[model samples]
Target chain A: MSNTADPVSYLDYQGRHKGILGWILSTDHKRIGILYMISMLSFFGVGVILGLLMRIELLMPGMTIVTPRVYNSLFTLHGMIMIFLFIIPGLPAVFGNFFLPLQIGAEDVAFPRLNLASWWIYMLGAAVALTSLFVGGGAPDTGWTFYVPYSVRSGTNVTLAVTGAFILGFSSILTGINFITTIHRLRAPGMSFTRMPLFVWTLYSTAWIQILATPVLAITLLLVIAERTLGLGLFDPAKGGDPILYQHLFWIYSHPAVYIMILPGMGVVSEIIPTFARKDIFGYKAIAISSLLIAFVGYLVWGHHMFTSGISDTARWIFSLLTFLVAIPSGIKIFNWVATLYKGSIDLRPPFLFTLTFIFLFSIGGLTGLVTGALATDVHVHDTYFVVGHFHYVMFGGTGMAFLAALLYWWPKMFGIMYNEKWIWRSWAFIFVGFNMLYFPMLIQGWMGHPRRYYDYVPRFHATHIVATVGSWVLVTGLLIFAITLFRSFKSRVPAPSNPWGGRTLEWTTTSPPPLLNFTQIPTVTRGPYEPAPTPTGGETS
Target chain B: MKEQQSLSYGSYVLVWLALVVLTSVTVTIAGMHLGALSIATAIFIALIKGSLVVYYFMNLKNEDVMFRVMLLVALVTLTVIMVFTFFDISFR
Candidate 1:
């Protein structure tokens, strides 16, 4: 169905309420997913501008633009905005809310009202964080980590930010609980766990992490609030509280929070690769189990982040060892994706191109993670640009590319219109190239002991800093083109085929921009998600 | 709901009695201050009480394997984290 198709889709489901109210008040998971997308992208735009400002300020190294104080607030806000607002909730809330039920052949999530409540809670949290910028002191300057002493002592609005994050954690937990219940109770009669799509599997694992791990963050942030207001001695050294305990609690959630950010992206890649490759996924069980394994091992590795904070040497060793082990499941997933591409009909579609880029970029991110995971190297690179580059590669590159891939992969299904292929490829090239150019030099400079979060740098680091700044310009342009081209497709509004990518999942069985209840009749999925397809001998044969 | 079973008031009383006995034993052990053994003993007793609540009071015994496994996984995760944190503090 087109946007103006005969059938009444979710876009018009809330006929009683018109415009924004209809969207905000509707309980349709699909509509809720769209609401999340719009709100998150708006926040993303703010984060992008903040990132660009930081890059501009860092261009010449010696107070080129903003002062050190402003730079501190900028980075802090950027981190808080990107991590809490965009990345962590990015895939699952937007795509997961939209597709999880459809993929499992359900009418909607088990709790549609609860699902809507999550979106509202998320917006409320995000608004609270952004509001911190205006009142109760300027935006938090303790950086997003909000390490104690300074966070407790700072005159800025650390309390509001931390409380915002606390509320957001609840939102995350609610979504997690809803997804868990939905997956367990709402799967169609014949759609067994193994028969579910990899996307659903990743969401399932991520939901567990969200439910269990997010509370630690909620409590930790509440402790920060307590420390800020009630003079709680929980994390303050002056009051006999160890600062490292803050680190321990923060990473306890934040580390698995990493998986919360990346796992869904991995899921998107899992879905995209098979569709583009025209082959059943290789080692499906391995990929599915690895998602769980990663979530399991993910909890133990939070200690690695505290190694340099003067945690015990034995703890360091244990954390380091566990960190290496966590990489195994991650490696298993990467290997399976690569193996799936082998001896197959690989289509170099925009979505596939983005998926391939995710593999390359995420590999760099994942490997560099090892460097940080190890004690010796991490000591040298702990607060350096190396850590910055590594995280961006993983977080931005990995999740960012997957987000784009998911956007492209599901765009037709989402809007019932096909975007221009030429612009899609062009945008992909710039993003891939510009992304590397932007972040890669940070690694080199960081390796050279160039510290991060510093407004002023020595003359020696200026060269690399300039290159990264220039790369930021290119990256921004590419991102602009990506957004514009996709948005422009609405003008022509060409109707999309139900199974545009020849996807085997239940989502593909429904109409593009599916109808009010998703399916006229719920599908009883007899076949596995990725059934085998003929190996096409056309362009880009793998 | 299909697995729901009728429980006599006497069984509830027995579970409550067992919990009380375990708590007093734990308290008496704590009063003795048997070095590291005191903490270990207290924790062990707490685990027994917790299991009894889960199995009987919570009716996990009659629940599906899936529910049991979910509970086990959560408990195991919590145990691992707590033990590891204590390991870091104690050993180093």
Candidate 2:
């Protein structure tokens, strides 16, 4: 962006083909990252619309718009799209791919061709997932967890859907392997493990979870498919299998999958807080190590999901304790972030503001998570709307907020464009209010003993459902405006600075839209990632 | 990486004593009938002993910090899972 007449960035560079084909076939990490961004936003839009329809159907209760069977399919597809398609692969596939190599001062990932393959595999997986909706018995009606017995008996296309999830897991695993190798082997000279950016640290930790745990998910899904098609007895009680074991394996990966959904967002906020707060991070070692600890400790707590399934009291209480342990690392991150913001030259910019929202909402999600983790409380709210609200607050409020922050923080750098600040603020107001308005009601109604995934709720639950549906309208309006602002930025003459946010990371060293090989010359990082440059604007600073 | 430290025979004996004490603490906690805390405490003690064996006897202490950290992560996760499953089967 510093160049008056734009230099050749990854955007302008061409390879074997022209235009879209060039982009698809390109091995460039940045191009693949852009492809992921475009694809994820498309899926997110569909997921949101599905969610909106579900909210509307719930607004008045008693078959307002959809049949009970149709409602079941809607929620199932919504969860599958949002989780497998958007959030799980969200940050790492998009921002991580784009920024990881850049921050570590590598030209591209360690496996560039493999990086391209991961995206291709992702598309194939997505195609398989989407195909299930149209073919066979229409969409799957078993809620996304695909709880067995029910999953085994459902006439809808559970097999195709589970197979799609299994393929998506392969894509996730390959991406994890690519990121791990790139981080370990490609850090620039003097950029020791301690010197890499916090985002890189989070990616490193997340990649391990992806590779280590995702295979369990693949195996679990495959078993579901095998049961549906081959009549396997691994999960069928009559054939001598316990259905409880299925929940164990699913959550074993899926709970850590929750951390995978969250950790990168933590990483994004870590970058945003230091840059906007205008101070080095507080407790860098703690934040860095906690990322790993969350990934590690996350595996111990999956059994809390199975308390009502008769998995024995011993497994129940032990899981409850380990679930509480997760709060420690999560709390460490929250405290360290707050300390970073305290008494610093704070700038309430777009990214940092998004981060503030994340902290508030995710804290609610975390504390309520404690309520959900306790054996006493969990038994009451296991399938209730309170559980639904807690999940949304964590996944959508926590991960979704951080995803917005990452978009705002990197939009300028990624494409050499900056969004209108005034519009961004207007959108943020609606989004922050609407997100809480929609999800908070679910918590209250859920506590009133309202169950989730039901076509008709008792009349007592109608008020909160209406409130949530209206909130969805407001939230969608905000998102539309936010999208418009970014679209409008492409034409604005406002030049993006090479280092727009005055970020200390290596990505700030090059042109705003970085060249084919990220840096003109690879940067040698001497100080810790957040350390300010010596003598203002020397090497590694614009 | 720093120079790897080798322990003297006295240090090894101290480690062995600590492991023995941790094992007894587990037995004592179980004897106290601390209910859920008993399982948690026993697992905690088991983790400590397992860490000692891995860190000292297996020479994980001399390797890279990431390796030791990784091993501890793996050991802690697997031990809890294995023990938790054991309790589930035993109680049934």
Candidate 3:
């Protein structure tokens, strides 16, 4: 039975198996990817609600909605949901799973069953994590970092939450393994590492970090559980264990986790810029190489997160220097993206708008990171709203915008339906304006010495918090419209073209909502991933 | 793809004997109380044993270059993280 001869779309494959079970049990990478997309978006919705609630609670000098205890739990849940559930697994699990095999001209990933198992594990882990909200000890208030001594002693279900994170780590590792194997063994005849798309390269680098770095997080969280249960002196001062060591172990996995979250977002941007600009990506090799460099150097800079935690002066100096080095590769990527746009036929589409917004927003995020990376500036704004603002800019503004851009970019391909252009632009406006209003003030308040996670704040910080809270409403409205627009497209009058954006990759050559076996036959590539668009017959340059 | 070698029983017995000899040597060295040198010797001995198992039993030695490099890269990454982490702890 030749797979290429099979005439069914992955969406409709095994129509005999009806309803949700088709999705839950199917091993098709595309179906699993859709499953992840639906689950991730649901969790993203939860995270956004929690975020808005936290912002509302901080709107005035005192609590506006819930008590301080509830507010504490709110922020913890928000961070836990956003980081572990949404951002870390966001791009790779959703887009990476769907596109990697397609882009590489393969039928499926190396391990389809393992891929499906990872998604189940992810849902199980998420369910376990949410259970903490109602079970023994209320939702963990130790915050997402689960800083120890407090974590070990807290009556909240820290063990369950930490266990959930550990389970999720395993999911990440398996996905990483699947991706690495698929990329290594399954590229089309002429495709080489350098010839692969930047998105694929970024996924490759991210998978490495996932496999290598996530184990440390698993062990660290397990130690947290052990400390809480077995009375291990691992990180408890009462038991003579140092709390700083816990920070070390946590950040060792986490600082790389930051890269795990952002690198794929960068890859998405790289794909968008070239297609919209109608040009081959500038500095393709440099961008691709820098991904690996960023992943490698990212591991060394985990020490920066612990500079003020009573570490030795020598370690501080070394870590501080390493932190700055990690920025160079990121800078190279940004420059190449901008350079790719220079003197090109720039299309001002919605995805292009988000890409431009990502460049602007991510730059702010990256630059502000330097301020915090410095030893002196970080000491002042370590736990302040500045760090909070900086983090949102990078995570939400950087990766979030990129995520939306990817959603917009790939929407047509995934659904075989066209979105309303006017609504797309409208959502972009609300999101762009709302995002800045929401996060920009935190930078100011943070610089003005406003601490984060405070149940209440003084009058000086109240005005900015109010602005931010108002911005949260706008951002949510924008996200609401964005979702509605995409959902409406499911019943769209016009079917999407196979290559809506004229993407110069294997995916664009196939059918929209591609068939069960990705291509009619395995593709044989002859050109770079991004080749120049053919000149019009009438001699138009663009 | 690799050609799976059918190892004779004699080779398996010889490998087993070599492992036993190494274990005995490690025990003798540990009994000598060589201080810091003992830790290094033990690690070195264990690496040899582990490599033997990986190459012979696990068949990584016969796998493609890509798999070997992947394994090497993982080992190297873990080593870098461990060594640097020790740098912080030891200096502090």
lDDT of 1: 0.89
In candidate 2 chain B, where is summed lDDT lowest over 10 consecutive residues? B73-82
Fnat of every candidate, listed in order? 0.36, 0.50, 0.50
TM-score of each: 0.95, 0.88, 0.94
Per the 3 Å backbone cut-off, how many clashing residue pairs does candidate 1 have? 0
What DockQ number belongs to candidate 1?
A: 0.56
Which residue pairs in model 1 clash with each other? none
Question: For model 3, how does the per-residue alpha-carbon lDDT over B7-91 read when each residue is reduced to its tens digit?
Answer: 7789878878889999999999999999767877887898788778777778886788888888888878877776677667777
The candidates, ranked best first by TM-score, are 1, 3, 2
Model 2 docking tier (incorrect/acceptable/medium/high) = acceptable
Which segments of model 1 are wrong by more than 4 Å? Answer: A1-6, A532-542, B6-38, B52-62
Better candidate number, 2 or 3, judged by TM-score: 3
RMSD per candidate (Å) reads 2.8, 7.4, 3.3
Per-prediction DockQ? 0.56, 0.32, 0.59
Candidate 2 docking DockQ:
0.32
Candidate 1 vs 3: which has more lDDT: 1
Q: Relative to the true structure, how large is the alpha-carbon lDDT of every model? A: 0.89, 0.89, 0.88
